[model samples]
Target chain A: MYWEKEIETMDREQLERLQAVRLRETLERAKKSVHYGKRFAEMGLDIGGIRTDADVEKLPLTTKDDLRENWPYGFLACSRDELIRMHSSSGTTGRATVIFHTTRDIGAWTNLLARCMYMAGMRRSDVFQNMMTYGLFTGGLGFHYGAEKIGALVIPAGAGNSKRQIQLMRDFETTAIHIIPSYALHLSTVFTEVGVDPRRDTKLRLAFLGAEPHSEKMRRKIEDLYGFRAFNSYGLSEMNGPGMAFECPEQDGMHIWEDNYIVEIIDPMTLKPVPDGEEGELVTTTLLREGMPILRYRTMDLTRIIPGPCPCGRTHRRIERIKGRTDDMMILKGVNIFPIQIEKKLMEIPGVGTNFVIILDRADYNDSMTVKVEVQKEFFGGDLRQLEALRRRIVEELKSDILITPRVDLVEPDSLPQSEGKAKRVIDNRKD
Target chain B: MISYQLSIFAENKPGRLAAVTRVLAKEKINIRATTISTSDTFGVIHLIVDDPARAEDALTKAGMTVSLSRVLAVVIPDQPGGLDRLTQLLLTENVNINNAYGFVLEGHRKAVFVVSVDQIEKAEALLEKNGFQTLDAEALSAIEPFHYMKY
Candidate 1:
């Protein structure tokens, strides 16, 4: 029943043995590249001496800065002629880190995606609609090839155009779809406006939501609204898009494909491995990548590994849903908070809309946070007292959630900026 | 009783009022009587329009929060004590006026006073019993202020 039954269900001992072999090959491949080769020679590291997964600690950690320093082809282990595709980050902060793939690498990625989708109960009979952005972003094509590999009829619908997305679901009788969780929440309103209840009208039964960090409450919200089992998928462009980990049918935690990558949870500050079940930055080593192998690439995503075995029988260890990216965490008034925590609280409130903007500024020699939320249109019809109550409720809820009382401003529905990809929830204007 | 006033929730910012007016203007909805009530950061614009439902729809579709509230329109003498007499009469009956605005129909003779009270039926009954004439939607829409002016 498994896509790669033997590889996926191999016992822990056997899987580690396989990882050791692949890890050696991966190191060898990295040594052929300019970036890792110089570093390996300069450090006098021996690729052959590294026998087990634990020995991988001997290698220095690779950061995003390392990837950018090398840039376009610095990490290429294969010749340019063998490279078939490349995907780069949006590079909003700086230079984009581009990951290249060979024909064999593409096949492996496709198989992992198919395995992820299959573990989540997708089958050949299902019609899959990919709702993420295509090109550059790995989410679109990553799931695309996987669904197609599983023999599902793939509809690459891309993103935005909510009305047409609904129309496509109706026309094609789409049974499965992949989308960002926030966009899915935003699309539910459009479905209501178009008068087509997604639960009643569409054939959608499964949704693979990822590419942004979200909370469990948000997942339940999508499931309740869309009438589907919303599975959380996790991956980064550095880790081959979205096939890195996925929730099995049990839906407790995402099963990280150990056969494909070496997963390590390390204290982001010390760069040392934390005990299992402890939250820390995820460092991954591409075990099977050919075009470029990133060894011990610090993902900067904070999550914990579930220590117990999954009932799904996949020997691949499971990682908890990403709590928050280290870079996305905000500190206000000596309190550390993530935007997802605020999102979880806001989604719990009935009248608060899905889109919200958190603005952090300096006021009166202290940090001030203002959460600008969009009030649902239905709540606007209520009297002034009701509106006042809603504002007070939001302020109280947020104060209890983030431990800091924020100024709450309720604006009109759809007033906040709607993100087509990667919702920008925070704006820090405090002059550092 | 049929007359409706579009009460809009607006923030106290430049161009907010202009935005609402622009939507009505685009819809070709004529504003009959307008009053703005403001607090520190927010305000409400209560407007008597030629078409209350259509104006509400236009403003709402333009992303402004609007509600159609039924308000009482009473006829009062356009004199120095016109509003005072109305207020004194309401005070005698213990009717509380939440909001009220007036405009003269004919100089020094008659005027129209629009009032929003906590209890509409009681205030209407009290006003009618006192012989103070109240206008319905039909009469209010037909009011032509400054019609006697040459310009």
Candidate 2:
């Protein structure tokens, strides 16, 4: 039964052949995008000359700085044929990154997203209310298209309108949800405020969350909200948004759609590939995308890709949940701080919510970072002393790790805006 | 009736007022009259100036956060008992008078009392209810043109 699927059970040789065939077409298509056209020329390689995966990696890795240098449309590798649509990535720290998707690319994404839903045992009879904000952005459209393609009735109940989202769930008998992990807790709050028991009133069985790195603690919270199993979906808008990979019912790790995108882990400093179980930066290549095919695009997200058998029986490569971003490190007093580390420390605090902000500033020629947090009410009911204790603990942990002291502020739950799509983490207060 | 107002932040140092004036002098901004309510560390300086906005901006850029507020200018009886009546009414209203000062209309013999209050609208309302008079922005500007002139 495990070896039933031909593509899933394909030998390494067959998989290599599949990747090479797709690479050839993607390269030919890449030449049309303005960004890649000049890049391929400068690289001194023709689309037809490239033969294998090594040939693809030998070209060069495209960084965010390179994308910034080209700006807006510098790296479009496709035109009319592969250029079906374009959208922007959330740019909280700097300029927004844009993503282009061909019609075929869109179909492949929906197919993968459908496979994700299937792995979780979601059926066409299930109703899903996607809570992503619709715009010239991939997050909302990615889930919306995928849900519809899977033949599930989807409500484009964009984020923040919790009142209607809840009503829609009750009225439509919504069985599944596709939204940011944070918003799911907000739903529980609305349910309680409206005097409805989530486990009692509605039929929410599964939740698919993406667009931000959430803690395992948050996954448990969402699961407890409606007695539904919550799964994490991972993707960047540059790589066709939210459908890139998702967790199966087993919840071991996210399954990377290797048939379409080649995922690799490389040491960010040395730029050399790391073996399985070693944490490194996630670099992705579009094995099948026609419009604007990315060749070793550095995602800046750090994770370990574990290649092996999944209980779900999908041959897709599994990536251990993200460690954090290397480029987007929060520097405090010459020390590198990451939001995921903050999340880990925060999750241990009983009352703390998953959201936190690293307030950045310049003081006396050194960076001063303050961690401001919000506590959940069930864990902390407006107790100032308890908040103070948590703050002291956080300061101690941050100090021990960064070797610099920081001020920690505890705020009320839901103090930070429940992000509609992208979560804001770093706050630069030097100017404001 | 006349009123003059100036906004200053609540930061304290011995030469803080001097710093404010020095910036005013460099910018050619004139000060007509001034009073500062100071605690151990914070000061709220309510002064009459040629330009309030520009002066506020200069002070903000210079690292002093300031907020502009309106004060009431009332015509007192020009007698000692006249001042007592207003302050007593204010005490009854529970409004702290942060600062107070005035100038005499030399020709008219009218003594104008310029009073700053924590609650401007309520203090003005109580004064108006008690049959006192006040000045609008234009009239206040005429007395303190240095304030209405922005930059």
Candidate 3:
């Protein structure tokens, strides 16, 4: 039942031995790049010292800033002709981090993705509908080839066109779909609007949701709405997106492919490893990548390594669902709040729609937060008093969760901005 | 009495109301009485149309959220205490009016007060028992406030 059965169920001792060999090869490849070669020469570091998996700490961490400073090609370990594909990060914050992949790198990524899909119960008979942006974003192509590898009828339905998406599902009897969590929730309304209940009308049976940090409550919400099993898939573009880790039928935590990536959880402030099962920033090292093998790459995603073995019988280690990115955290009134916390609180309350905006502004020398949420269309006919009561309930729930009371504004449906990719939940206008 | 009102959820934008009207006009649906209640960012347009079912289908098919709710249309004298009299009677019966709007049917003589109540059947029975005239859907749709206007 396992993809790459020998490697997936490899015993701990053999897994570590394999990791050590791959770690040595990865380090050797990393040093071939101009960036790592300069660092090694300046620090007088020896690549031969990385003899075991535990010795990976001897290497300094690679940050996104390093990739940005080097720009287009400083991390290239091969000639331009050897590189087959390049994917750049969505530069929402600043400069985008671009990574090159050789043809072999593409093959390995596709195989890893196929393994993720098979572990989640997807088979060759399943019709996979991919609903992410295709070009630069890794989510689209990453899952595309993987589904194709599994011999599924792949529907390359890139994001947006909600009506058409539903039509496609109905026309092709789409059995499985890969989509972002928020977009899945947003599309649920479109299904209702088009008079097609996804649970009743389509032949969909499985969903792979990822590319955004979401709560368990959100996962259950999607599953309940779609009447199917929604498995959480975790990945970032730096590590070759959407297939780094996947949850099995157990549906507990994502079984990270340890054979491909040596995972580390570290305290962001101390830059030291945290205890097992403790929450910290995720650090990953690509063990088999050829074009650009990033070592000790700080992913900035906050998650803990799940301590025990999964029920799925895979020897690969698992990580808890990502809580929030370190950079995505917001401090208001001296209280730290993650947008996912607010989302969890909102999704639990009935009548509150899927779209919301958290606006942080300054008023009278004090920080103020306003959560503008769209009231579901069914709730719009409610009287003013009922709407006011809903607003107060939302405020109370948010206050209890974030330790600060926020003004709640109930807007009409489709009033807030909709994103086809990652949903932007925060708007911080407070000037530093 | 059964009176139908089309309730539409609208965002607060410059041409949002115009868009609703444009749809109704295109469908040849005549609006008899209307009320707009707005919050900071959104509002609801309650319209008493000539054909409630047709208006609802047209608006919904045009991608607007529309609901047809039963309301009460009470006839009141076009005088100083007409609204107060109707409201005071309903207050005595403990019936609350969620929304109400009125338009003069004849100069200095009569007007129609359209009200949405929590308990539609009970409010209608209470108004009729108190000797107040409640117009049905046919009577409501037949109202033409501009009949006395001279060209």
Candidate 4:
């Protein structure tokens, strides 16, 4: 059943050969790509010269602006007929940069996702409720196709309407749900709103969530209510989709399918790859992609790579869950505070409500940060003095973490703004 | 019993006033009289409601900053001499007014004055003995189907 040796566990020598051959094909393919053609030539680099992975760092890295400038068809390396499916990024200011996938490309992605799901202890007999939407976003279709390819019965439920998701889980006896961890919390919230106990009612055993940064404190919260193990899935829309890698049962880190893709960590500032185990931007080159091939594309995500045999018996290289994003880092008083650190702290305080806003502004010459946290009035004694004291406690909590004093503003229950899409955690209004 | 009136802080923005009113309206709160004291970033709105506790509860739910302090509500005659009488009484008692706002209680035969007095219970007893009417802390917030804002 594992005839896919090129994807499983190929030795270094064999991998080098496959990568060398595939990389050449990718180079030729890139030369003809409308976006890369003149640019590659202007950069004065020969695609034929790239004989090894070390040769990749020499090529100019692709940026998000490059994709936008080229727009929909610029990055297409193959004809339309060969490409069976397409996906695009959300929030298009101009034209959307469409991602094309051929049948083989789809197969490779499905296999990778299946392997990720498999690592999380999913089975062919398991009924997976696909909660992510299937459309222009890669998250939905990527996970949906992967589940079906694994011989599992997949429920294409998509997202939103938590009641329907819960009902289907109970009716279909859903064993695994493919959704982000934050959305699963929304499900538990709905259960409480409707007076249904999630612990006693839900049949969900495992939840796979991605597309945004999360924290381990949030992981424990989801596990506590949904009665399931929450696994973090990682991927980018341009990088194919949610199957780039996934957390295994041991939950140490996500395992990248080294056989099908080449993973590297590079210092985004220095323009050189960092040594293994150092935190840097992730770059990937899909060895098997036919229609839309990405070579050493800089994925702005930051995490350290662990190159070792996984406890799950898979020889793939593992990566710790993303610590934070490089672009999201805010420099305040010469100190850096990532939104992820706030998320971790927020999760530690239960019933603090999911909605919060980190107001950022300049106080004096230094940067100021105020976290406006929402608390249920029932928790407070309806006294402003008492409420102010609670605010002080939160200020103390965050001060210990950020090493800088922050003003804690307490708002009423359900007072914080609610978002229909991703929760807006940071409201940075700094001059920078 | 002595009662205190408070001027609470609110962000200066659109819909902020409406939001504050909606909370009080939901509870059938009666704001006897009010005035917004504002600055560049925020504003403090001094108010006398019919039911202070109920209004405070509602405002708290809506996430409004509120605080309580003793203030004097003195009754003045409807004639021009009414304010003269109340001010002279406070002056004689050596009570200084932090601020003052006057509003005629509709359908009432007399005018009412809200005074940020140094002492409230003393003024209330003095004004009552002088046959002047002064609203209590609860009465100030209990404005029914309010004439202006359903306060």
TM-scores of the candidates are 0.60, 0.63, 0.60, 0.60
Which ranges of candidate 3 are over 4 A from the true structure? A91-94, A329-432, B1-151
Candidate 4 lDDT by residue in tens digits, A312-399 = 6656778988876756655454234666667667657643655678887753223578887776434543233344555667777677
Q: Per-residue lDDT for A42-72 in model 1, tens only?
A: 9999888999999989987999889989988
Scoring the B chain of model 2 against the true B chain gives a TM-score of 0.67
Residue A369's lDDT in candidate 3? 94
- Arranged by lDDT with the best first, the candidates are 3, 1, 4, 2
RMSD of each predicted structure = 16.5, 14.4, 17.5, 14.9
Whole-model Cα lDDT per candidate? 0.84, 0.70, 0.84, 0.71
Cα deviation of A358, candidate 3, in Å: 6.3
Tens-place lDDT digits, model 3, residues A1-432:
787899889988899999999988888888889999999898788889878888888888999889988888888888889999999764222345788999999999999999999988899999999998887779899999999999999999998798999999999999999987767877888888889999999999999987666678879988999999999998877898878999989999998898999999999999999987999999999999999888899988899999977777898888999876767767554334667678888989988987999998864334689999887877666355566678889999888777678999887677687734677889978642
Per model, how much of the real contact set is kept? Answer: 0.09, 0.00, 0.21, 0.00
lDDT of 4 by residue, B1-151 (tens): 3555655555456777787788778888766777775544345567777777777777865666666666776656557677888888878888777667767656654666777765776777777787776766755544332133211
Per-residue lDDT of model 2, residues A1-432, tens digit only: 221266655666777788888878777777776777887789787677788866765767888677778776676765555477877765222345666777877888777677677677677788988887777656677778777877889888876677888898899999998876645765677788898887989898988877766668768877877898888888877788776878877798887777778777899999988887789999998877766677788988988977678876677778877777877555332133566666776787676765677787754323467777765544532123344566678888766655567777765445475635567888866421
- Flag regions of model 1 displaced more than 4 Å: A91-93, A329-432, B1-151
Model 3 chain A: worst 10 consecutive residues (lDDT sum):
A88-97
Candidate maximizing TM-score: 2
Against the native complex, each candidate's DockQ, computed on alpha carbons, is 0.14, 0.03, 0.19, 0.06
